[model samples]
Target chain A: MEGKVDTRYWRFCLWMGPTFVLVFFLCWGVLGHNFPPFPPDTPASEVAGWFRENHNGVKLGMVIAMTFAPAYGVWGYALAKILGQVIRDEHNIIVQLARLGAAWTTMAILIATSFWLTAAFRPDALPDWMIQLLYDMAWLLIDLAYAVTSVQLFALGIGFLADKREVPLIPKWLAWYGIWVGFMFAAECLMPYFMNGAFARNGILNFWIEFLIWMVWVPYLTICGFKAIGRIEQE
Target chain B: MREAVQADLASANSQSATDDTIPPGDSGVWVFIIADMCAFALFFVLFAAGRIAQPEVYEASRQQLDGAIGLANTLILLTSGAFMAQAVRAARKGNRAATLSGLGLALGVGLLFGITKAFEWSAKLNQGIGLTTNEFFTYYFVFTGIHFLHFVVGIGVLFALIARVRKFDLDTTQQRWIESGGAYWHMVDLLWIVLFAMLYLMRAA
Candidate 1:
């Protein structure tokens, strides 16, 4: 009975991680709806038309997306908690860098969602240029400014590597995968170039593969954390 | 009984790791290196594909890039790799002084490369050749920028290696740690070579 109670805390920590992952699923603002946003060279009128046409849907999506603004900080806290399991220090440098990245991502998410909301806040209220400007800003923040999240993932991988246990807190493969996913987000840097090809914001290298890798990172770490819990038996 | 027990211990140690069969460094670093390599390879492949699509733009970008500086950086990295190879060789021979010096020299060369590369990047930026200037400059700034980031990381690895060498001991774990750092430095060099080839040397003209 005591053992069950003890494990519940571990399970709860584990649950916190996957819960944010679910929040991530709800974070499909651009990718889900106005995906690929407007191309870098998208005309102001065309972008204005999007908000005018999909005003309600975009606004609703922005609201959901804004959830990530605060939600990402919560997500980062959950991740930092999990990171605590593998990393020893309360303020370890790598972990600190990760926390910074999380905070930055949180702010970036807020700014991005605000941009989207402003764009959808009544397209007729502003000039086409302003609508277009907000639209571009929002998409760029969402896709290209992924470095914040990527840094946290890299820090997690490094933390796993630094663990001295014979059986690591997080295994090497998953650690490496986290690092890969983080670095691969650099692909978004290319999205501004080719609009229709694989590097396009919506295309494979930048969006599909990179996005898929990111979606996998959280759940993968959650599972690794669970496995680590099993190894440290109370008895 | 004692003689036999000593003999058995010797055989066990011998069987554990031979020079030919042993991995160069810690296994974890290899995983990190391979993943890093694969990430770079994807970018390389994408660069190739992009070049094929817009050969003229890529070629023009390639041309505008100052290849002499690229060549100099390559030479710097190559020289650093040689120093690291020497460091490992000295470490293997149990020559602590030579090992420390070799690693120190490599670290110096790495720092030099980083400084030179920074100047090169600054020069480009001053010329108004910035990211988002065009598709060509996009890859230009992005690739070099990421590579520079890696280069700094490699320098950090080398610094750690130099410290480890200064605390020299010819034990298995220490040897592996030092070797791992050397191997990683070599990987940094190898990656830059490939990047220089792709970004500067290979052009349509």
Candidate 2:
């Protein structure tokens, strides 16, 4: 019975990966500004124009994005269950660290949504600088602070290598991929520092390349975790 | 008893042949290592392209770097990598003493690299060089910072390897661990080789 429950939990975890991508795309990709994100120096007047152009839709997008933000916590819960089987010892601090990372990221996403909503809430009466402030904060939260996600992945990667289960949960190499991606996300810290170059928020390396890599990583983790669950249940 | 000994000998012979054909370490670590190299390759390309686009900026920045320190660090990493390779070899032969000594040499050299890097960074900081100093400094700091992080992680892995080696004999898992450690150390060495040439040695565009 306990095993059955675990299987169910992981299935939900797998599902959330795509759910995140969908909600993320609907807001940040489909509804949000351009892919690397709009430049930092984008004037408030331009943002006001966008808000005027897409008012209700922008608000609705932020609401939807905020609603889906808690999916991070569920993902973390399921991940902890899976990783716990391997690092079931008292010294498993990384597992706790991973949970903290997940919580921090979720809070961050919530704050980011608030920033986006503020930009769209009032444009005509508010000063251009105020709207621009909201815009800058939102994008910076997403791109500049990618280190939070990096920590989450790094913890998971460590879990994979440290897991001594007789039937390992995931392949150890996949763990390396997790660690690699986590490290790469650190590139985004340079995003706000570059307004015009490839490292800029809207630039190729920081925005386009890094975001695409993360998209691929989401599905990879989901499929691999799903397979590992199957293997564990069969055992 | 005689038949059991013969069976053992047969398996031992087969094991060596397998070792010759298969790559070192777990297939898992190799997968990660290869992908990591690909990422570095992209960085190299981007850095080169950036240099080409802003030749004067890159050239001026390149002149400010200390090539001698870079060269020394390269040799240090190379020597440490060599020691790691020797450690793996000794572990395979079940020579505990040799393995420990090799690991120690590698660890010491690896630590030296860290110290030298800290000095180099502080010197640059004293000179008012920073991540946002210019395009060249930005790339230089970010690139080297990321690599330095990897080096720190690598040192931890080395320490773990040393502990494991001292605590246990070269069982199958231990053998795999040795391979994985060697693979990781070599990666650190390999990344530096290219970074040195590009950041410290290559002629300005």
Candidate 3:
């Protein structure tokens, strides 16, 4: 049993190792670069100057939407599992539907409200064209909701399946997988807010925290998932 | 050993065929769906930001669109989606005839949508409102054009499924695929509903 557990751990580390590597590179490559020293007064011209220095917001937006969002697809699956349980407990199909709707509505309202904090939202921080492009991508509020719902569903599905005496649905590794997956998703939603200094100065720490988490978590969960698949096939 | 292995493989394949074998929904498919949705969402975001940048231009362009046609298309698509949903249920019951008929109805409605969209595009084109005319017109054509592309693909899939009706054994795997495909088509239809409201009804807003 101990050997099996360690094997799963090793497998998880192997799978998530790349995600950690990417996160490390991103942190080092992006945050490590010498930013033209912070301006004391962010003049409109100075801001424009700073923006001109960077690739457009459109590029940045593309990076966020394409690279970042899809990377968290598994997390979305996990979150869907969790949310599905909450929905199931409600017992009314309409209420369950409404709850899903409410969760989506809440996420949208929050994200939109975040945008209103333009000082931090910094549409100009990225390139202008990219920002406009990202702006277009941002309308995918339902997609975001789906991502969140998916994670919720996965979490709940595992638990629900485990309860059935018949299929040994929740593999031993999955519980560990769940914690990490949950962390990644929570990070996805919270990182945006924190990245823009919504919480505190030097919120760059959030990035570092996420990087550290991914380094350990991504490979671990991936391995666990693959193993789970193998076990099911073997059975 | 080789013969034994071949026999084992055949058994596994046949078991997969005959049994309740819904491909797990937790796969790459949802990722693709979300990514596609994001692409469309990006377009919507573009619309919102453009409106922010040039509300007057967008408002004027929207004003030029016919609300009545837009509403009619919305109802047609919605009805089509309902038919597709019914087809999914019928397919589950192994009602091949009902599935084919339902799929045909859905396809017909989808084609009608394409025709109406073509007419709408042409009307705009005739009125000097090509993509190059203005930013609003640019988005108008782009959004509707992309949606029409999805509709075309959906119709193609429905047609392909109709043809496959003869071979499709009523089984879990097939059901899951059809259900998801139908769900996706319905989503496309539902999205048009919102687009119609935003484009036509709220023109004055």
Note the DockQ of each predicted structure: 0.33, 0.52, 0.01
Residue pairs whose backbone atoms clash in candidate 2: none
Question: Model 1: per-residue lDDT, tens digit, B1-205?
Answer: 9999867555534222334565777776777788778767877777877788889888887888889999999999999899988877667666788878888899898788988888998998898888777666766776777778777877887788777767667666666777878878888888888888888999675
Q: Which pairs in model 1 have colliding backbones?
A: none
Predicted model with the maximum lDDT: 2
**Per-model lDDT:** 0.74, 0.80, 0.52
Docking class of 2: medium
Best by TM-score: 2
TM-scores for every candidate against the unseen true structure: 0.79, 0.88, 0.46
Sort by TM-score, top down from the best: 2, 1, 3
The TM-score that candidate 1 achieves is 0.79
How far is A151's C-alpha from truth in model 2 (Å)? 3.7
Residue-by-residue lDDT tens digits, candidate 1, A94-177: 878777777788788788778878888889888899998887677778887888888888887887777777778788778877
- Model 2 per-residue lDDT at B35: 76
The DockQ leader among the candidates is 2
lDDT of 3 by residue, B146-174 (tens): 67766776888788777777677857656
TM-score for the second chain in candidate 1? 0.88
Candidate 3 local lDDT, A73-163, one digit each (tens): 3333333332333233325343344335325434553453223222224544655444333332332332234345434434433443333
